[model samples]
Target: MNDVRLYSKTDFSKCQLTQHPLYSYIQTFLNHDISCLVENCRNATCYAIEFGKELILVVDAQFQAGQTYPTSLRAQYLDYAQEELALTEIKGQKLLSGAFRLLKTIVPQKIDEAVYVGNYLVSTNLFPNFTLEEVQAIELLLNKHFPNKTIVYRSQNSFLNQELMEHLDVLDYQPFISRQVFIAHQAQVIKRKKSFKKDCKLAKDTMFDIRIDFDVENYTERIIELYSQLYISKYSKINPLYTTVFIEAMTDAQNTQFIGIFDDEKLIGVTMSWSFDGVLTVPILGYDLSYPKEAGIYRLLTYFTLLRVNDEQIFHMSSGVGPFKLSRGAEYFPEYIYYKRVPSAKGYTCSFWLLQKLNKILIRISKKKVF
Candidate 1:
């Protein structure tokens, strides 16, 4: 049986991370090891649960005047969010019994070499309880739907959930797709109640005048030109999601805000934020590199973002690799992910028959990849 209960925001500290099933890096963002991972689409709130004890704390981000709390109480800091964003209520029991679960709501910001970005983006996350045969059955089913996507059988996110992974024998399988998925989230704001104030950094003898555009259509191509520079500068290899049409489509979505900083005629940096409900999350930010002496492009944009959106909405700085945003009062909010899958009917009928064939092939392929 799974322990799923809800408590007030004050209970997050009582959470013990050592027992949860995830990686060590998450400790900075979550109050307990037993956390929940939700997409950045809604007023995402985090529920801290002690899977072993069934103890749970339902904490949400609230923006109240003069609200403050210790950093350790993860939810209290959520009060600093920019607006009144509502998140999905944790359906305690329903979550515990899902038929299938997958990891990676989105891709993390930082990119490293040789890591499979596809796996991070597309791997089907499952809990740690099924047998090896059961896992293969699931994969075979998915292959039928997404023949082009790669699937990796990876470990439980942390120890609290490790047993399920161990029991299922999922971590042993290799990835069919080559890329690792990356996930990220950040704060987005409605127009604030307060004034929009920004400390603009202008070069003393500039050829262009600096202007800000709320209309994305005005500076989209320019924004991409600037962003592509930062991306190419950082990563030796590039992902083609940066094409002009793609950038324009994402920037112009109804629930998104694509903020731009222009140097008279040239675009310097752009902040592309996605929205749902009232929460707007900055999923991507890019700047022009030729203006290295003016490294202030992104910094100026962020300040403008906070000051402009502070009074109305809360910003969602992600759990991974965002020191700049984190430093500007974005606090830690723990998230958890759960996976459970019941084999499809077609396979269940002939489990004994297919297991025999799939298991033999799996072992052989695994050895080939290893050697």
Candidate 2:
């Protein structure tokens, strides 16, 4: 077998995707089913590199040069918002969510505003760290495929070091922020703090049941209702289309698992998790907002989710809920988003500079205390 192959519906079914890393398997799946979500793209594909049955790197490629810029930006933003944002309150969250929807509707996604070329949605940073040779191979392929267009990458700090940046035209470090992750072996079971412990205890006394399989016939409507309601009120950025596709993907993926938390036979909360490469990731989670906060449904969900995780597997709790995840012994790591444009693309460079300034200003605003 070739060391590197870009699969664009080239008999991928024969290959064992499960043998690859988690992120790679997801990318391969998306490529195989790209028509379901995106359409009429030039070279949308998934790139994979393997050495003697072991996967080295996986890249999700979307060559949208001929496509309109706004559509690509909107799709990218939807993917980002779906993965990153979450909220515990309703009022403020709703306002922010509406504003983002309006912004996406009104603002034109122009070519000049494009920061990535054939973007890697989930960088190798999150999976098994790529070796130096493999990283060089990725750089070469990216350069060949997107010589004029700027290629952007978002990765955890460990992979965004000086050596990698030296090969790129420009590297932009996003505002310093940490994403929380749970390392099972590094984590020791601990009692929740006083208030949280009280809440968990209260929730335990109630008749709450946890179910681990996804039955579309029995759970689809309720799951959609809860997800839609929570996405609007709990996330600042909302993507209706992506949410639909995501729900479909979660239900269809063989390695995926669903955790349904029920209250007296009624579904009150749901979590979508994926198990791969000795790791478990909690990607989608939400509870019915109608439940009073005092009901402690969220606490109950977290408690049981952690209990099901084995000590040998890494639990990717995912981003958001910083204070809560930290309390549960999650280690913190900074994620870096890198941007680069060739010297000829002056328009993009100027746009990126302005964007960097805007990002800094927003960071300052976020740091200020609300009265």
Q: 184-276 in candidate 2: lDDT tens per residue?
A: 324344344454466557656877786778464477667767765665446533223223444665576556778888887889998776665
Which candidate number has the best TM-score? Answer: 2
Summarize candidate 1's per-residue lDDT along 155-253 as a digit string, tens digits: 233222345445334434321211112122233322221211223323333344334436666665676566556543453122222445444445433
Q: Residue 21 of candidate 2: its Cα lDDT?
A: 43
* Candidate 1 CA-lDDT value: 0.35
Clashes by residue pair, model 2: 70-109
Clash total of candidate 1: 56
In terms of lDDT, the best-performing candidate is: 2
Number of backbone collisions per candidate, in order?
Answer: 56, 1
Error of 2 at 205 (Å): 1.3
lDDT at 218 for candidate 2? 70
